[model samples]
Target: MERKVCAAAVQFNIELGEVEANLQKALAGIRRVREKDARLVVLPEMWSSGYAYKRLAALAEETPRVLEILKGLTAEKNMVTVGSLPEKVDGRIYNTAFVVDNGRIAGRYRKLHLFSTMGEDRFLAAGDAALVVSTSVGRLGVAICYDLRFPELFRKLALEGAEILCVPAEWPKPRQEHWRTLLRARAIENQLFVAAANCCGIQGKLDFFGMSLLISPRGEILAEGGETETELSALFNFEEMTSYRSQIRCYQDRRPEIYGTLP
Candidate 1:
């Protein structure tokens, strides 16, 4: 019963004050996802620092060390892994998405949209590049935390031939409905696969809703995890995306001229 395109999400309760314990717990989930024959595995945002971006610079992870751990894990498990991490680059701390596959750091995506309303701008440096990593499974476009709120980034990725979108987020409570609504809307509109990995439990003063989802191109909820530390696993069909795009044909029927008509 091995599937070529199996996926899994780790919805873990990240212990806010215990980074070591959280890392250990999350490593276990990554291994579990591999054992289930998942070609792609996702972990929640800031699974290491627990969304404590205010202290990110002081506790930020080095690119090499994080890359080493993930490289080893992915090499041993032979699965693609993605999630958020606090990264220090060029003397600036960024909220980043680390992508590991086979035996190397495949790619990294930094959060472009700083959640200024939540004071993220005070802590983390925003990224400018839109990252899409190529893997054996497919081309994966990654966005971290608050980057999920931007439709333009996703559109650019779709145009760049990305088939699967990975959104690793620490989305909070009281806005749980928005999370689900936005995820489905993104999937349906883009005609691509969506895999959301969300953190559960409290970080500092914020509580995250861990209802991570794996959505089909047609916006069908292929698999979903509840608001707990659990795993959501499913097998996805790659052809469904192409089929939906052809049938919907929204991209073809675009009014690009009106968007930039030279008056």
Candidate 2:
């Protein structure tokens, strides 16, 4: 049996350091998509607390209010949601993405590669592990903004049976080309779906390019957004992805022994 479902990526304008306001905006976006009966929804990184780290430590939430809200939303709407926020855990802060499925916390993936250019390395602790969570939709691999630049991470997830890679980003306008190209390349090379949710508006001096996208296994853009607050949705057929993978046979032809010796 082939499984197919509609998924959405939400793009919004995040106000810096305003946790409550940001939460409200994110909730509204989720509700708007639920009205259209989207089962899987993704939000950009730092949607709860905008990516201004100087004030992020003060704005960060130590409580699980964000998680609780997501749990309730997913349960009420019968949807799965993926979003990232500043997490204060045991006195350290992490850029963490939470997977809320059917009113429960499915898993959390912290940003493994911190953006040194933005001083993320100084403010947040980089995550040590890659994460893939199974859901009714499919096995989803979660990654944050800069993680898209690392193809190795996506490759590892695809090899581990990930059917979809959900990237929650706060990508800027200056590198919009890199954002689009990297996302398509990841999907094409890994032969899986890539759903990226990015933000709009500005945080300090950095202006975000809100080009949220949904891509197929063969590097096809299923849905895409522009530089505005919007939601992009697309239907994905797992059977088609499987058929494409079988035809390409890229995974089966891997010469792991030689490649593994490089590092």
Candidate 3:
């Protein structure tokens, strides 16, 4: 990994069941960030189609094609990117985030925790494993919307040599504080970088508050977006993370033997 790398997140309005429109928007956002020399980019969850439950199966069918497009773009720009799309596999639908690094599919993280409050578990099959993969940029840990609430998962990723965390979400209003606090807490506790993308605007009955963020190991907000369609970019310095970790000695002082290991 380079000592420093540029990362970005894209936020936009996801129209329900409008695969083509949403795809074009995502592409535009990716290009915009790439132009600014961002070697890694993250997009919002279910970006190709909002929570159009009635057309979810059909929408999921487009994920492969969309991924191909992303692969080509990443290769052309020499970038690594991640975003969530509805995936249909073996007749089961899952909210899956695909990590594309330089034209290859680096890894996939199916959302493990479905938001039962919104009936997500009823429609989508949950993922059983977490993802921490090596990419063109660096080692990355991936998580979806609801997965952010689970600190254990993030801790596992950090312990497993993940240097940066990428989150793709479609979080709605009335809980913006939770999003901000949890993201910072995850970075601070794990002593790594975090880049999260969230959609903005209204889709169906839900309104999304776009506050995509890029945070440092010290819980500093390097870059952030507002409640609108936009892109936020920041440079992540691995040396800074190493310095902070050495100074804090959090990992060195861990008592996993007494507290039990994380799965």
The candidate that achieves the highest lDDT relative to the unseen native structure: 3
Q: What lDDT is obtained when candidate 1 is compared to the true structure?
A: 0.83
Candidate 2, 48-84: lDDT as tens digits: 8887777777767632887888889898889999989
Candidate 1 vs candidate 2, lDDT winner: 2
lDDT of 1 by residue, 1-263 (tens): 32248989999988764667777887889888878888798888877876565566665754456568778888987788888888888889888888888887789888899999988888878898998889877899998767778888888898888888999988989898889989898888888899999988777788887999999989999999888899888888877677778889989998778887334
Ten residues in sequence with the least summed lDDT for candidate 3: 254-263
Candidate 2, pairs of clashing residues: none
Q: For model 2, what is the error of residue 33's alpha carbon versus the real structure, in angstroms, after optimal superposition?
A: 1.5
Local error of candidate 3 at 184, Å? 0.2
Poorly placed runs, candidate 3 (over 4 Å): 261-263
Candidates' TM-scores? 0.94, 0.97, 0.98
Please give the lDDT score at residue 117 for candidate 2.
Answer: 90
lDDT of each: 0.83, 0.90, 0.94
In what order do the candidates fall by lDDT, top score first?
Answer: 3, 2, 1
| Model 1 TM-score, 2 decimals | 0.94
